[model samples]
Target: MRILVTGASGWIGSASVTELIAAGHQVVGLVRSDAGAAKVAALGAEFLHGSLEDLPALHAAAREVDGVVHLGYVHDFSRMDDAARIDRAAIETFGDALAGRGGPLLIASGTLGLARGRVGSELDQPDPAVHPRVANAAHALALAQRGVRSIVVRFAPTVHGAGGDHGFVAMLAHIARQRGVSGYLGDGANRWPAVHRLDCAALVRLAIERAAPGAVLHAVAEEGVATRDIAHAIGDALGLQTVAVAPEHAAEHFGWLAAFYGADAPASSAVTRESLGWTPRQPTLLADIAAGHYPGD
Candidate 1:
């Protein structure tokens, strides 16, 4: 299959290119800059020049490829609404192009906010009103009815691995370095699910290859790791003290991350593993942290 992968120069997107190419698939990666194009070329993927905001570019790429793996997302938290608008438009363009073609459209989503205080599974539905991206995910799943095999893979918040990861764990490590202490919210009991970068890339490959239409998959390896344990890991790596911040002081201590640091967003991947036979064969979050990939600069 000739796959068009958006965010192909990104962290997980780059890994997915390697995984797909190893499985004998041709990849055309969407890149927004010369640097991104060069990175894609180094990975042996053909490059398509465009940003996610370019609906026409998205449509053209979708029409030209056998499948699409939508992994690109704007990370601007302050402009989430704008990012979501672009994502929805891009998804719609791809759906329109693949409507009657039976082509696979595997999109990246998140396990957070799907359910609160419990382990979220593929069975749970995200409230569209909660976030625009959540609504966009549902829109992609509905494309199944339009003759497209659309699959949504919900990724854990902390997709950890070797260096180059700038996700939650890395953020925490950086904060710890700046503050001289690794802190978690309240008693630090809230949980967060995690998966290695390589494992996530593997799941993306499996979904595009075999997932049924409207299938929702979780790319979680550890269902839940206590936030305190995570803090301890960071503390150990940076030789800093691990402390708990009161809920009232969380914002001051952790900055913008306080909003998510206290969330108990554990997720289950049992169904994904059973359905796709995806066994994660990579280091766990703590192991990866201990290996020093997240040592704060």
Candidate 2:
């Protein structure tokens, strides 16, 4: 299969391209810059110079590929409307190109707020009100009815790894270092699920290879690692004390990350594992933090 992966220079996209090429598929990564092109080329994939907003380029690339793994998104919380609009346009463009074709269209989503205060599963429908991008996944899923094999891979909030992770976990560490204390919300009981980037990439490869149309999958490894535990791990790594931030001060302390850090979104991949025979062999979140994968190492 010839796969076109958007955001192919990203943390997960780079890994997914490597996984796909290793499995004997040709990969063309949609990149917006020469640096991104070089990065994808270094991973043994061809590059298509484009961004998610470039529908003509995306449609052209989509029309030529056997499948698409849509991972590109403008992740600006301040400009969520713009981000969602761009993502929705890309999904629609891909859907238009692949309608009646039955080729896989895997779009990334998140496990957060899919189920509040409990463990979320593959069957839980995303609430667009909770996050702007959820609506885009819903749109992609509707493409399945038009003969597109649209699969939504809801990634855990924390996709942690060594050296290059700039996601939530890394931001937490940076905040902790700046504050001199690792902090959690309220009583620090909120939980967050996580997965390693490589494990997530492997799952993407498997989904593109074998997952059914309209399938909703969880790219989560640990079901939930409590926020307090996570803070303790960060504190251990950074040699700081773990503290609980009150609701009134959360914004002041964590800035735009407060809402995300305070979510209790645990998710299970049992159905995904049973359906695809996919198992995550990555280190646990706490273990990664203990190993100094989060900075201050």
Candidate 3:
């Protein structure tokens, strides 16, 4: 199989490309810049130079590939509308190219804001009115009606690793260092789900290779690591105190992280594991943090 992976130079996408290539599949990595192109080429993938808005290029690339792993998204948190528009356009473009062709299209979605206070399962449909990304995933799933084999892989927020993880965990450490106290919302009872990067990559491979059309997969390894526990871990790493901050002051105290750090986002991947025989072998979230992955120097 020749897989077209958008965001192939990114953290998860890069790891996915490596896994796919190791499994004997040729990879076409979509890159928008010279640096991105070089990065993909170094990983032994052919590069298609274009952004998600470049539908003509994306369509052409999609037409040539055996499968697609749509992993690219504009991560402009302050401008979510832009991200939504780009994501919807990318999905539409990919769907148009692959419709009636029955090639697999794996779309990336997230586990956050799925279920309010409960654990989200693979079967829990996204609230149509809420997160814009949910609708984007729905659009990809609808492609199955047009004969495209589309699967949605909703990722846990924190994809932690020992090397080069600049995501939530790293941001938390930065915040703790700046504030001098690691803080959590209210009683600090809110939980956040997490997965190791390699484990996430392996699950993506399984979805690409064997997932059913319109299948919804949750890439959650450690379903929920408590917010207080996370604060404690960060404090331990930074030699600071883990304290509780009121929910109203989360944004003021934690900066941009307040919205996410306050979410109780436990998710389950049991069905994914049973369906694909994929068990996560990576270190637990706290273990990864404790292993000096989120260093405070």
lDDT of each: 0.93, 0.91, 0.90
Candidate 1 lDDT, 173-255, residue by residue in tens? 99999999998888888899999999999999999889999999999999999999999999998899999889999889888
The number of the candidate with the highest lDDT is 1
Worst 10 residues of 2 by lDDT: 126-135
lDDT of 3 by residue, 1-297 (tens): 999999899989999998999888999999989999999999998998888998889999999988899998898888998899899999999999999988999999989888877899999998767877888899899999999999999999999887788788898888888889888889888888999988989999999889999999999998899989998998887789989998788889988788788888899999999999999998999998888788754
Error of 3 at 96 (Å): 1.1
- Residue-wise lDDT of candidate 2 within 1-297, one digit each (tens)? 999999899999999999999999999999999999999999999998987888898999999999899998887878889999899999999999999999999999988888866789998886767666888888899899999999999999999887788899899999999999999999888888899998999999999999999999999999999999999999998899999899999999999899788888889999999999999998999999999989842
Off by over 4 Å in 3: none
Among the numbered candidates, top TM-score falls to 1
Error of 3 at 245 (Å): 1.9
What would the TM-scores of all predictions be? 0.98, 0.96, 0.96
Sorted on lDDT, best first, the list reads 1, 2, 3
State how far residue 54 of model 1 sits from its true place (Å).
1.5
- The residue ranges of model 1 lying beyond 4 angstroms of the native Cα positions read none
Candidate 2, backbone clash total: 0
